[model samples]
Target: MKFEIGEIVRFRKKHPCGDDRWEILRTGMDFKVKCLGCERVIMLSRPKFEKSVKEKVEVKE
Candidate 1:
């Protein structure tokens, strides 16, 4: 899936904070995302990111 900055995404697994959703902060060779639950920022390699993501969340404006 194509990921754009500011878009929300859902992962296959939930975060430690108990949320499965994350907001995309940056994208490229590596991805920077913030946990929706804990508001923690994390960076993940493209490979790991693609494997972890279940879908790109479509948020209503």
Candidate 2:
């Protein structure tokens, strides 16, 4: 559940744009994520985001 800025992650669900990859833009009570394929930004609650994220592409640093 711990991730850093500039990290990439894949979500458990596919976006409407048909992509699963996302980059972490910011993290806090809410997370800011951008779709890797379409570069769309979305803000989600921490728990919701944690559930949506399938894997982290970059290790926490």
Candidate 3:
């Protein structure tokens, strides 16, 4: 699973704000993600984040 900063990803579960989409802010041993719905930021361990990811939302280059 390759993730880059500024990429949008869909999670297996919905966020508290009811959105399942998140934007990747930082990626490494841990990932910094922002909630698209509430603009909230959260950090999760790489392994945990990977397991929660359902799909990577394609970004138009």
lDDT of 1: 0.92
Clashes (backbone N, CA, C under 3 Å), per candidate, total 0, 0, 0
Q: Write the per-residue lDDT of candidate 2 for residues 7-57, one digit (tens) a residue.
A: 989999899999998999999999999998889899999999999988987
Model 1, residue pairs in steric clash: none
Pitting candidate 1 against candidate 2, the one with the higher lDDT is: 1
The better-scoring model by TM-score among 1 and 3 is: 3
The ten-residue window of minimal lDDT in model 3 covers 52-61
TM-score of each: 0.91, 0.90, 0.93
Model 2 residue pairs with clashes: none
Select the stronger candidate by lDDT from 1 and 3.
Answer: 3
- Positional deviation of residue 30's Cα in model 1 after best superposition, in angstroms: 0.4
Backbone-clash count (model 1): 0
TM-score of 2: 0.90
Alpha-carbon deviation at 47 in model 2, angstroms: 0.7
Q: Give the per-residue lDDT of model 1 (tens digit) for 7-59.
A: 89999999988999999999999999999999999999999999999988865
Best by lDDT: 3
Candidate 3's error at 4, in angstroms? 0.5
* lDDT for each candidate structure: 0.92, 0.90, 0.94
| Candidate 2 worst ten-residue window by lDDT | 52-61
Model 2 residue runs over 4 Å out of place are: none
